[model samples]
Target: MAYSYYAYTPSHTAALVFAILFSITNAATVAQWIRYRAWVWLVMVVAGFMESLGYIVRTVSTKNPDKKGLFVAQFCLIVLAPVLMAAACYVIFGRIVYRVVPVESRTTKFLWVPPGFITTIFVTCDIVALLLQLGGAVLVSGTQPTQSNVQQRIQTGKNIALAGLAIQIACFGFFSIIALRFHFISKQFDKRLADKTTDETTEDEKYIMVNETQRKVLKNWRPLLRVINVACILILIRSIYRVCDFALGKSGYLEQHEWPAYVFDAAMMLPTLAIFVYWHPGKYLPYLGFRLPKSRRENL
Candidate 1:
């Protein structure tokens, strides 16, 4: 007799909800990309597309739990999609730090820890992590009654996937610390300067100075900083959940239950994507020194 374990039937309602959510997010993201000419955010667009597709696959799987192909497709897409989103976040934050943050305020070595270097290292790691996860999924897809080594292959693949998730969590966590440090140092430096200037200036001068400062910070860096941090944290949590799921082995509570996947994966990832709709990096990249050539700018 074939043993049926954590491979329970998926909920139709849950799949539908994710499908709708991802679709809406995808449309909004595409609109943002088009309106802003944010070609750089193509990676994010690809991530959203994968997420939508994964949910749609999940929706199909709900109707047929025994369909191995549906399970594998959804598995690969959902697991790897966030890697691309995290990469996009790294690129955006790196550019923001390089352009907006004063060289003196940054604790990291500007030459070695430049945004480009940080982005490159993390993105490379994300690619490696993604490949490891996908490879694991492939290896585990052979689980069937007739397959003698199915359990071994599945266990090995799960371990590889867990390692990948760990790497992702570590990368995101390290970058979050770096980002928070830079934010704190810059704000502290700005505050001290403001205090000295206000003490020395006349009332009228102080008012103008304070007003201008507020406008500058609000318009330039604050919103992007908040959105990026929140998005990263959300994805980090989702990655951590995935790590636990894999850690539990094949029959783990999280892995066996469809609801956990919906909550940790879908709910967590949706907000991360939605955050970009309002604070699309394209809207602020121009302020970060990213620009088209004069001729191109004029034509647009």
Candidate 2:
């Protein structure tokens, strides 16, 4: 017989904790975006905002696990929000890659666009899945018995969302590999250029010092890029963890146990916020040359 009601007490509480944290993080990011006029910061803020809403639904489910309607809302919004955040990371990093990589031989000026397109497609699937599951759950709730068939349909819609996440993960892995490879290439190219600069150093000492100083400023970029890259990778890891949660026979941790539920809520949401806090690239965004939409510029 199909199981009825899903959720654990501790897990629900954990979800609320994550909810509050992300809400604060998003609000701060929104403030930063207004000050800086950057689209990427806006994207991150929106994702965190949506995640907070999803967590609110999970908090509701703590009281009534049988409220499958709320359960679907909790799953759909919370689960999909981070992918949007990851996409923001991809765009910001790609733009940096263009600026940081030595121009003479840079091969990927447009690297960010394709990933953006792919993420947009994946999110579209998530939107379709969310509507289907939310609508289906609402339909299931009205029926007296809420037949097994309805449950199965609800689960199927979730699979669609899960499928989108899975594909997005693969996209992330691809981007990670590309980012690492690009870093290595930048290193090699910079090394050769450095050697040439050293050899060409003139008897006139002032010119060499200027070039060396510029080199130091460029080198400072590596550490910051690494921090941003790691943050993005952390989100990818959380997505993998989520795939394990949903992809496994639709294992509702809410149905089988509480620990997995808490693990997911606390482990997954915390790092993204931490990353956003650490890399707060609000200052460097002037390099993007992105004009704020008229409304945003006017707001400031």
Candidate 3:
């Protein structure tokens, strides 16, 4: 049984924009995952595929505005899926922090005393919140449209999504702090490790995590991180935006507002795609340069 009742229309402009963006991001992140191949990246791929399908579904929504089932499926999958991806990103952060900054000298991980433990607590809460949202959606089909029960379920689902986004954002904030510490640690490391010179062989390979390298060393994180960062933001923003879009649908104002469509497809999706378009590392080999074959690279 489906939950959401709203049907969406395609904004030709927005859909085109989102389509182009999704196609691009899809390639970049896939490239990212191919090299990393870390368990978390696998999870991220599932989540990313689902999110991309959501945008595709939105494109479907544009062509046939009356297809309620398509609308509901896209909304549920697209909206809920990204949170899980963000969760995977959350999991990646701990190891990343531990790696870039050695635990002995690390202040950021345990800066608040409990360290990664605190994030674990938040992850647990977010999971419960996500489950509740999924469970609540199930009840929607059985409840009368105007009944208090139906209203309660809708509100519960939206609230749960909101809670998840809020916590994830908070998690990002903490991670950013740790990443800052990582930056400082990197500087300190460069000073120390620089004197020793890097070797292509040895034990560094044993513990070296694939995700730690900034998207590109020389290009900087501004672009790659921006794509991924915005990817997370889009996931978060999509959640809050849905609540308003749905609420406004009930009140009868959603169709008239062009901003919703524009922001989502163009403002949000395009820049994200551009990240992939601009940062595609065809020249650089990933996953220790072995997980992917030589044929896959274009040569630097």
Best by lDDT: 1
Summarize candidate 3's per-residue lDDT along 244-294 as a digit string, tens digits.
554443444653555664565335444433443345332221222212233
Q: How many Å off is the CA of 159 in candidate 3?
A: 3.5
Q: Which regions of candidate 2 deviate over 4 angstroms? A: 1-12, 108-145, 188-219, 250-255, 288-300
Q: Tens digit of lDDT per residue, candidate 1, span 151-243? A: 788889888888788888887888777776666655644554354343334432232133244212223455787888898888988898888
Model 2 scores worst on lDDT over the 10 consecutive residues at 291-300
Model 3, 251: alpha-carbon shift in Å?
A: 2.7
All models, RMSD in angstroms? 6.3, 7.6, 8.1
Q: Give the Å error, residue 213, model 2.
A: 17
Off by over 4 Å in 3: 1-9, 35-39, 107-126, 133-150, 180-186, 199-249, 252-258, 261-300
- Shift of residue 238 alpha carbon in model 3, Å: 5.3
List the candidate 1 regions with Cα displacement exceeding 4 Å: 1-6, 103-107, 110-116, 188-218, 287-300
Please estimate how well model 2 matches the true structure, expressed as its whole-model Cα lDDT.
0.56
Q: List per-prediction Cα lDDT, in the order shown.
A: 0.73, 0.56, 0.49
